[model samples]
Target: MLQMLSSLLHHGSSVPENSPLPYTVKVSSRAKNARLKMTPHGGLVVVLPEGFNKKHLPALLQRHEAWIKQAAARIEVHRPEPLPLTENGLPYTIALHNSNEKWSVVYNNQGRRVLDVDDAGGRRLLLSADVADAELCRSQLLTWLKRQAHKHLIPSLGKLAAAQDFKYAEALVRLQHSRWGSCTSRQLITLNTKLLFLPDHLVRYIMIHELCHTVQMNHSKAFWALVSKHDPLWHTHNVEMKSAWKYVPAWVSAQS
Candidate 1:
């Protein structure tokens, strides 16, 4: 079994004893290219970059044993249960949790990890993990979501653009942790797949807002006018979007 180590900087504190990491870090040579990142808890992750030094990290961990112990203790006090899944190579997600939608989740063992819709009239929207490592399973699930965004958002963005009299150049939908929509000067508009979980009206407003960016890059007065033209009730939807983020499950996306 891979040995788990605690973090050195738990709770965002710089002090060594108060930290939440553990003693004796586990390292691999490939870890040189990667970084030692801490999860929301004290879980240690050694992200390996190219030319990693696997042999050196464990010795370093030994040198800092006392600090690691202190950090682990801190993690026990402040970390929440279910352990925020990021350490297991899977993060929590607040996705597709709509009461109106009929969806289910499961794990499946394919050559690679993936979350896919079994359009076979399958009642469950979620799939089972077909892989051994929890992290691999989550990577596959995220890849599935990315595919869904590309398939669904293109047409949706087009329709919304037309409704607002904006000519669309191109559209790309992605699974982003913090945004509903973003517009670029190149006429490239991106929508977050998470938008699907919002109330229908909010979804409509988000569409309209991004289409408006086709004409204006800034949130200027004319921009507001355009947004208001498409969505007079947009203010309400905007507030809902912010509040809705809280309900999303944890560790659903790539860690920053």
Candidate 2:
């Protein structure tokens, strides 16, 4: 297992943790260029390619300071407050969309140091760990969420495509925090795993939305007309999706 350590990296020695425009730097081997993105909970993230000097972050921040501030302000307005745990310090329930399977979380304080989950079609899951270790619980929940998405969302996409006579080259399910889903010109549809937390209607609408991209690559008038033909209530679904983050537990959403 990989050991996770948390630390801070400030562009300037005088900058404090309370700086209004504070940010985090993530070093990735796959990154060939520096990129900045505003996340729902992680705030501003500066992805730097490996072997890059950290000192240049100050200059880069200066260049995009205005954009960063505007984006941060926009995200803050829609950010949902983290869900509070019950008196027992456990999540109330773990629900899945478009699936009849049921699951429950049980934290084991004296057992092995790992979160164990049981996805027994409508069965309870036991998290064999202490309640105080919220991070471990969050990690386990995120893992379970991804599994649920694959089990439910992937197959549903195929069915939806066939029903609508929409052909796609491929589909991918991921834990993206920025957007719910996307499609490429190659007809590859990528969906966010968090969609499992949304309502059934919204989930179907999103699937239809992406499948429509297989025909209309852009969000032009024809693209929306296609989406409307499939999901007549696409407008309401789109508006409802804005508040879907409230369904996600703070622990998972905070990792964005």
Candidate 3:
């Protein structure tokens, strides 16, 4: 099955000061082995299968220390510079590339905390909040982003699945931190709201990737063969995904 860690522990926990790097542990019921995952933004995550002995973690880290340092350095070299933020700590414009929509955000201090799209076919957003209460504005904007993802991303995924004759139970959208998308063993697909920032082709690639997982739960040769059949450019898209985080706005990470 496509095992995914359901619980995260030691969120900001790190090894000793002299250790290689900071890391967190994740417990996965479906995991059959312990593995390490490194992401540019999430840093390092040590995933352990259920019933695994915690005492062995030290040994695992020691063995992987060389690989860890190399991977960390690679990420550091390719990490994109942070996006500049507006003076009010909010994005002046919201762009949903997947939907070919760009929204201009207008902040109005009408003494109320609310966000609404203008009548220009939803191209403009009117955010009414105390300009100083950036936190509230961000929360409201995030809620709106979820709605947009539901309106755009979910339907697009459904259409793609139908076109490819892929069977899936349901699809969901959330503000995920490290993952672009995931598919459960039960055939449910969860997409990150940050996808709204990606190009349309990449978004479709992620959808197809998850849909293929519904048929083949593991990334074996057969699974990749299936993906290749559906998305001929899966390899190119996969490489592009490694650096796609740059498309997302700084405010999105700030809210997280």
Candidate 4:
């Protein structure tokens, strides 16, 4: 992803003078080159290839300083407000908009650490853990969220693929930090569990986007054309996706 961002930069381009901004440096063995990524939460991240020259970082950052500031400002405009927290700093409810289901969370201190899906049609979650162990509760909640995603997202993707006559190997659900969904060369599709927080239409759009990747791996014009053939409103959904992270509860990423 960082490498993809670097391709947008103009090599040898002049940038205006600006104060150096605080940023984090991450070295990735998979990185073919150094790049800058401005995340909605993390302001600026400089991803460097392993063994890359540290001396070139100053010039590299300077060259991309303008882009970084602009990206940061854009992210700030769409940044989500923090979610409301309970006394134990956990969410009171888990809303899976994609599945059109909302589950109330009832935390119980039973001197045990476990989470149970209530038999009430799975509309309630019974969490048994030390209230003081917020991290444990959060982890349990995250695990539950992944299970929900697995139950819903995978089948939904399969249905969409079948309906559209698209073929794929398999679908999997995971908690991804930087992507909503991804498709591998072997046709395996992995969707982010956080996608459950998004609206149904947007979630469908993401699935379709990944499904399109099975045919066209890159974001070329032909790929988008294919997507348009299936989802005429994909453009609108794509624009809305820029700020869709706001729908995700804060606790989901609290420990991330």
Clashes in model 2: which pairs? 102-122, 106-127, 108-129
**Which of 3 and 4 is ahead in lDDT?**
3
Q: What is candidate 3's local distance difference test score?
A: 0.81
| Order of the predicted models by TM-score, top scorer first | 4, 3, 2, 1
On TM-score, the leading prediction is 4
TM-score, per-candidate, Cα-based? 0.57, 0.63, 0.69, 0.71
Best by lDDT: 3
- For model 4, the superposed segments whose C-alpha errors exceed 4 Å read 1-83
lDDT of 3 by residue, 40-107 (tens): 45677888999999888888888899988987887677655554456767887787778878788888
Q: Per-residue alpha-carbon lDDT of model 4 for 5-48, expressed as tens digits? A: 21112123222245456676777899999987764444467788
For model 2, how does the per-residue alpha-carbon lDDT over 190-256 read when each residue is reduced to its tens digit?
8888777767897898899888988888889998999999998999987766556655555555642
- Under the 3 Å rule for N, CA and C atoms, how many clashes does model 1 have? 38
lDDT for 191 (candidate 4): 92
Q: Candidate 1 residues 1-256, lDDT tens each? A: 0011222332322223433444223335555443454443335544445555656656545665675566445545643333234334454433453224444455455544335566587544354555467666656666765665666667766766666678867787776755778878888777876655555676677778778887878888998888888899877866555444433334453343
Span of ten consecutive residues with least summed lDDT in model 1: 1-10
